[model samples]
Target: MPLHLADLVARSELHLSVVAAPDRLDRPVEAAHASELLRPGQWLQGGELLMTIGLLLPMTEEACRAYVQDCAAAGAGALVLGLGRELPYQEAPAPLIAAAEAAGLPLLTVPDEVPFIAVTKAVFAAKAAEQHRALERVFDAQRRLTAAAASGRGLTATLEAWVDATGIAAAVTDLLGRPIAAAGLDDLDPFGPAGLPPAVTELVHKVAGRGLRGSASSASGSLGSVEVQPLGANRLRGLLVLVGTLAPNDRMPASGLVSLLSLELERRHLADEPERRRRSALLGRLLTEGVSAEHAHDVLAVAGLASDTVRTVAVDPSGTSAEMAAEVAADLALAVPGGLVRVHDGLVEAVVGDNLDLIEILSRFASGAPAGIGPAVPPEAATGSLRQARALVAVSRALGHPAQTREAHSARLLLEFGDRRALRGYADAVLGPLDSADPTGDLVRTLATWLDTGGSWDETSRRLAVHRHTARNRIDKAMRLTGRNLDDGDDRFDLWLATRIRQEMKAPGT
Candidate 1:
């Protein structure tokens, strides 16, 4: 409609002749621009009606053929050549016309009496009229959409009406990868095969990164597809995919309706963010309170989790920067499927279903992030295991090292053993120097025995079959090695705790 070659020729009232093909009328003319140089193809933009005179190049068969090929590659809708006294105008240039015909470049010869200005003016006038009509249609659609929106009609309904009016299919989905509503194809389910295609799903997944609107095939075996535009902030909301099969492409739906739909969708999502946050909070509480698996499933149903069975993983950061901890958690969440939420004090809890790989999940969590990981547990066991993971975090802090336990029970054991300051001291006293100096064998046996005997030196000496003085000296040496004062009453408690830790560490296959 925007000034096609036929329209230009009709308006100019010039004796036009097509020296080129009679069969190239199928191509749509998008716009009109003029170029007079021989190598105009270098500066050529596609979908234009290029105007020129054969003045810049030699009138030879090879030159004409090369020029036509360049016009084809540059996507010129049609070529208009002006005949004048400078170039021989006795008859149509057979070689140039033949080359143009072969290359599918529609060639229109301009009369010597018709000024190029008249041709340019006619094309501009036609284009302006077409643009004005398009704008009127767009304005009417916008008004109807605004009215529907003001009447408290939901986004999906408004979108449906818009699509119906524009004759294109439209759909809306949420960030969780579920379609909320759709129009045009009543038989197809936009969330799955009956509606949108896998390629559309992939595009929607990437919509968060950029604004997207392009054509794609339908999963319903339709010959043509639609242009999907991601809506909402950060393009996190679903998308508005316009499906149609018009010849030159439907401008009303693709451009006008799509723009309005994106704006409305973005507004809806912005208004819904607070409610979404509230729902997230409620779901988090449900996950933390040891809900039954069925209850968890129901909660997930409300939250729109796309899986039935799920695994729970807990992450804890000890002695690391909080920023680093958050980045690790965020990266891990993005790398996995299902939903991930950060709950209460640097704890990142995720619910993954059986569909995902356990080892790869764990490896990705640990990669490029230094943090303690708790073992994976089933979804229903998440609450208890999460608590255990917290306990293990405490143990890691107390021991000044990274620690991991696969289950709640094991984590609890490690946490209890690590909590005793005296056991830590005793382990340091006996094993510390030996482990550091020789890096082999255990020397914490006497300390473990002493603590087991309730810190009674006489009983400990008898157990070891040594003099009480020797046992006292050994205790003193151990205390000194561990950098704790044994003579203090407070140090006795510390020694008792440290001795317990040594016993646990020395346990078989610990």
Candidate 2:
């Protein structure tokens, strides 16, 4: 506890008296200063007890009021008057008393027998003792926290010890403001809002972005106090958030706690890196050929995954650069329990057991970014499942849907089996005569447009920027050259398949 005016006056040796409105004696005295200048407040700082005589003060009420007002404005914690020799008055002046009451400053009176040095010595002794006690408390808390961390359950134990010491709730969050660890809160979300509160999350971003340490509080008292400290060096790693009241001295210990927590988190990260790499390689092997089912089952059992059946998800972060999307996917995959994630050929793939909530886990990583999820399949069929997911991703992007699962897009499986050479040969066989007959290629273009427009001649003509009759003639010429009857369902299917095959061949990697 700090030294207050009441604590000073209660000492029997000092023989101090409370002269004017003494209701405010609870104000803490951070320091003690003695000055006889006309305006002693000039040399004073807030939370200080200013002791003086009436030597430089005027007898008039107005002069005394101005003097008291200045002390109050200067944030003087209390005014102590020595009234035996310097000033002939037996008590504090009436105007000074009234002004102190109005300004809510405590006023104390000391006898001439008590030397000024005695009061200063008392304040010094009290402050030193308080400092010693504070240090003791901080050191003890640090020891307990260190013990908790070394006891094998480091993260959770450290957090629980911090709560016991500070009586405050704390949470550790990633750069995305998602909580990775928490204590003293009912839910895993210790921030009190769904996900992270946007205001504090924005602050976390700024701190991580600029390598800054920040503290903010709610004046409305709704959130008490909030402090954010960055983790890691050079680059931002994570953040620590504390929500509660803390004394000025408590802040130092809080910072020390943050440093300890960061070390533990980084230690775990370094320790887990090798395992993460091993799981990634295993997933890669499973997706490729040559890994036997028995060998794969052994690996899956070692990694705590189902050996027989697994589900894989392919995330397509449309419009984002491949590098950034891959990084996010990798992080999410590693975070998921018993899951393996890999990024290849512009897609993020995760292989997990059948019991996981695939949608919820993907949503956490996707965060509104579009993705595609393949159906559950046997371990040997993982490659085919991923291909189906990739095709669905393409279909979803083309149709302007956010995401598509295997059940919603089973037809996309047809796209998985076509050989590039065979597809190209078939396309040429179906459309080769039409291409040779029309030097301008109008017949092929008209046929494509007519098919895309659902065989509506009017819509096809409007899309081609030509008259309806001209479009009709082009279609008739295409049918005659191909020797395919337009009214036959089989011929129409063949024409559509050829156009699709040609389109796929023109794609970048094909």
Candidate 3:
């Protein structure tokens, strides 16, 4: 269905004849150009017909062979040697013929009466005619596609009509990379349990992460060449993917399809705004103020995040607007079913079920943003999860990456999630009188050091760089104020643990 060297040679008006590589005359010709330089191949692109008048031509047998090799190497579809009155050669040279035949490069001879301009005109005319016909077909296909879209039959019918018109398989995916609609041209169905091809799926997320700045890109994979086009007007709504073989002209219909499909997705997104707002409100309520376990479960169930246990994932909205962070959360929402995402206070957070793999979800959608995943907790205890997430989020930001609560490996885990009132009461009851009386931390340090050294006065004094008498005096004064005895195992252990807890919580997370 493409113009080939054989077609040009077979034309009666041009008076052209194949001089070499007769069997290889079927090479496709994409364009035509003329040059008289020795190595004319320098100007040629692949599938071009190069015409020369033998000026400054290589005349030797070896030189001719190299010339033909150069032409073939440059991906010239055919070589046309003009034989006319003013040209160096009156006919095809034997060396040139031998070289062309050896290299399997189709060589054509133009009759003296036929000028090189006629050959160039013929080549481009055929190309223009082909393009014109393609445009005509595209116009017809656009009308059919528009009708299908206007029929209100949804994306499938519009895609089906486009496929029937252009013979290209296409699919649409949400920002989460979930397949929304797919239309295959023939027996190849893009929609299956296996889902979209890995390359297409990757591009979907890549474009989704870029939001409004995203553009179109293509990749080759198991499905051959696939092109991904981002869909939306003011914001990203989804991705439109075209898979399989595509002609240059095929972009015409694909663009039209993108416009039609983007409108539909935008409409759907607008329609879902109220529900999204409600879910966001519920998440805010669940995070800031405590929600009843039953009401939390109801909210989670209504939001589609149904799990007896769930973890809270929070991303600090640093160097980005709340709107931008919220968009990122919305993009991540489709990474899993029942993934509830919202912007509460200043952080972009999500309540995801523990049953799903959080790591993989984050890997696929989180990109470069720092995320902190809190420990799995019940719906009623989500407030604590948010607390832990806030604590770890700073660590993640400082580390310039994401982290999980399980990765903390410190006392902050228990200290953050435990009852704040009870822990505060315990610390105050244990350290209150001593801290008030001493004002400085010497007494607490002496008691902790003495306990750490197994009640060794000398070791405590040595560690503190003080005399044994001074350490003994401090310990006695601490005992007098706190009413605790170091010789008792219970008192010693409680004192040590309380001091460590206080030290760990001294610097809090923002």
Candidate 4:
């Protein structure tokens, strides 16, 4: 229990007496401080018991009232006015007492014979004891949680320990809020037929969607106050939902519990990593190379992906790695329902039952990098889809955003399967003159725009935000570089094809 203003007055040895707003004596006193400054509120935090000698107090009644109001506004637990020697009167001034009463500020009087040191000592002693007890609780909770985890009880055991320590119904859930472990709230099925109850569902969204690490609650009956806490660092691994409102003192333990649960969950993922790799390898082979429908069906079954029609998504690698690709694919599979992801040919590939928003999911984990997607296709046609997705990857990089195969307009299919070395050599041969003079890519942008607009200078200028004369000048320079006549349809078509091939290979126009 916190010390209150009445507790100090009740101490007969202290020689303190209440003079104003005695009814509000129950307010908790966080600490007792002595100040002689006119406006001590500048240094005073709330919930403090402010003790002062009358030497620095204003002589005017109105000034005294303002002084009292300042302390109250600063959230002082109560004001203790010394009433002898330096005091103008034997007791608190009439205006000061009246102001305190109006503001519901508790005011106490200390006789000059009693020193302020006694009050300060008592407050410090109580605060120290409270802190010691809080530390004890935290240590005890940590030991129990560690013991339960070591007992091979898994996440469920740790959650049970949290319930025992905090006396609240607690649960661990996946990103989608499906309960993986629970205690004290058997009736609250986070994955029930109707899914998590409305109250719990709303709180889960707030925590996961907003990336809130602190507790969030819903004020609903039966469900009561539900607190949702996130459970990972860097990226959210899962959620921790407590059914009842936690005590103010239990907040620290709740955070520690989240840390412990995150470690245990990560350990579990590590233990299963071997099997995940095997699954990723199989899926990778199936997507990059042509596989018979029957053979693909068998591989998908073994990988736990039972989808007949799956959408292929391609993520351009940040760096090359088969292991990194496998890890990312496995993580995506766990995050999404009924999905298989793998790394094939230095790219991350995901196949999902539905065309789930891989962009949104990747944003949660790996943002800033664009992804390419192929339209949904039959399982046997995965290689064809991967080919299309590969093409979209180039398109995506060229457009500086995510792209889908269905939206592709260039000769992407031929570009994706062609020999890379041969294509780069051809591009350099065709656009070398332009690259020599225009290394800033201004000419390349102009050429791309002119080709896209079907040689319309007006539309090209509008698209590029340039004047008509500027667009024509750029086109003239590009034509001179390539030594092609813009008026000749054959020359224009050849340059357009070369530009398309260059974009697909991610090579500069040169």
Best by lDDT: 3
Clashes of 4: 0
List the lowest-lDDT window of 10 residues for candidate 3.
409-418
What are the lDDT scores of the predictions, listed in order? 0.61, 0.74, 0.80, 0.77
Cand. 3 TM to true fold: 0.63
lDDT of 4 by residue, 1-510 (tens): 677777778889888888889999899889989998888898888999899876777757788788888888899999888878766557888777887888899888888787788888988887888788888887898788888878887999998988888788887887766778888876764536655776787778678776645657777677778878888765567888888877777878777888888888778777877866676677676765657889888777876778778777788766646665555665676776656666666777777765467666766544445578888888878877767887788777765667787558546544655567877777788787888999998898789889978888899999999999999999888988789997888888777877877676675542
Off by over 4 Å in 2: 85-87, 174-178, 187-222, 233-238, 290-333, 341-510
- The candidate 4 region of ten consecutive residues with least summed lDDT is 409-418
Residue pairs in steric clash, candidate 2? Answer: none
TM-score against truth, every candidate: 0.49, 0.63, 0.63, 0.62
Candidate 4 achieves a global lDDT of: 0.77
Q: What lDDT score goes with residue 215 in model 1?
A: 34
How do all the candidates rank in terms of lDDT, highest first? 3, 4, 2, 1
Expressed as tens digits, the lDDT of each residue in 207-298 for candidate 3 is: 77677675556756556777778888877777877877677777788789889988887777667667667777777766657578998888
**Candidate 3: lDDT of 130?**
80
Q: What would the per-residue lDDT of candidate 1 be over residues 165-194, giving only the tens digit for each residue?
A: 577666776533346777776755444555
What shift in Å separates residue 292 of candidate 2 from its native position after superposition? 9.4
